[model samples]
Target: MSDFVTPVLLMQTLAAVREAGRIITEAWEKPRSIKYKGPIDLVTETDVAVETFLGKRLREILPEANVLGEEGSPAARPEGTTWIIDPVDGTTNFAHSIPQCGISLALWRNDTVEMGIVYLPAEDELFHAVRGEGAFLNGKEISVTDESDVEHALVATGFPYSIREDIDIVMQNLRAVLMTTQGVRRFGSAATDLAYTACGRFDAYYEIRLKPWDLAAGWLLVEEAGGKVTLYDGVTPFDFGKGILASNGKVHKAVAALITDTDD
Candidate 1:
């Protein structure tokens, strides 16, 4: 593989993400123009504006690369040197002026992630990770927690937009997780959930039916920070269209049990 991970490239990616994040915060300050992709899935004008702007910025950073952004790239797949972007990860939270939204960008190639970034404009936090190197938050190295006991671990999760159909399983897993862990939180933003897992604020996170842009950047973040990312099965490789169970390595199997095949 060619060298896509460099100080210069990471710097450029961060600048673009921070620049794009401004749109998220700016929109939160105004009345949102909303539309529904489904009964529960939301789209705001700012989501489109940020993705459009960020996609162009990323292409400039790697002119030969493909840009697959959630807002516009419905039919696009991960081609050579693809940059996957979620312009605003928590559109509902953003539309409601909630402060938990963020922007996620990842560079994927040859069936692997090369680099990833998740920027929370409201908190002014920029988290990043490269494939072999460890993860970072605001240029400082970071890692997942050392927590090993499920009874003391703080886990996070998000509901699917297809909640109505998935509710039975959702509640089953939710109930299992709640009974197994110290606490469970629903942040409405998978990027935030994964970022928190990476930085040790959360011991683990799990959610079903996430999109490519949702898991691309944050998956690398968790693993690079000394955590684990996988499907509920605990052995299968996780990808864009798969459900995820991400946790500090010590608690991965334990958490996986609760969210995966817990008996009712």
Candidate 2:
């Protein structure tokens, strides 16, 4: 792996995600055609259109890297760099014109994420992070909140599309969190929630069974913003396939214990 992320590389990656934002923005302006990927999952013409644009743009930006996009893209290049892209994070919301969706992108290399960018086109908010440079919002530096009291913390969360099969589990966790934290929010977009947590809009965020594209960018943003991210156990490392617990470091352990407490 390279020792550092170059400025050119960062700029190009940011441009690709932003271009993706522009694509979604333009698509949102016109009539929208929506489709269902499953009973609860949604797909839109804009999702495919933006994915195609991102697939091409990202490869052009980093020819050496492979792409894994949510909308029918190829598998990742395991040995080299990989760009993970979620063309539209909240397709249902986008289809409903709810303006809660965004594009999520992340770059992975040598078993670690090097950069992440989440763009909410409707809101014109761009949240980005370089591994060591800290997180930013539309070029302005941002940080996680310092709230340590779980009862006073505002946390965000989402129900995964897999909720159909895991409704009970989702509900159990939701109930636990609702009682433990000051409040809970369901924003329909895990990527957006994580960005909000990174920027101190929310003190913590957690969710289960999310895809790589959904968690990759957001996880990096939280970490770079001086937050802690881990599995529900708070000791296990966070990966896309498992449940996640992210907080502003101060409340991380308390939240994790609550979420992972079996007797609750």
lDDT: which candidate is best? 1
Residue-level error in angstroms, candidate 1, position 196: 0.4
lDDT of 1 by residue, 7-122 (tens): 89888888888889888877767888999999989898999999999988888988988988898987545878899999899989888777788898989988999998999899
Q: Write the per-residue lDDT of candidate 2 for residues 1-264, one digit (tens) a residue.
A: 236578888898888788778888887768878788888888989999888988888878888888888887655322358888899998888987778799999888877788899999999999999898999999999999989889999989888777888777778878888998899999999899999999999998888878888878999999999999998888777765678888898998888776642222
Supply the TM-score for candidate 2: 0.94
The segments of candidate 1 whose C-alpha lies over 4 angstroms from its true place after superposition are 261-264
Clashes of 1: 0
Which regions in candidate 2 have their CA more than 4 angstroms from the true location?
Answer: 74-79, 260-264
lDDT of 1: 0.87
The total number of steric clashes, by the backbone 3 Å criterion, in model 2 comes to 0
lDDT of each: 0.87, 0.85
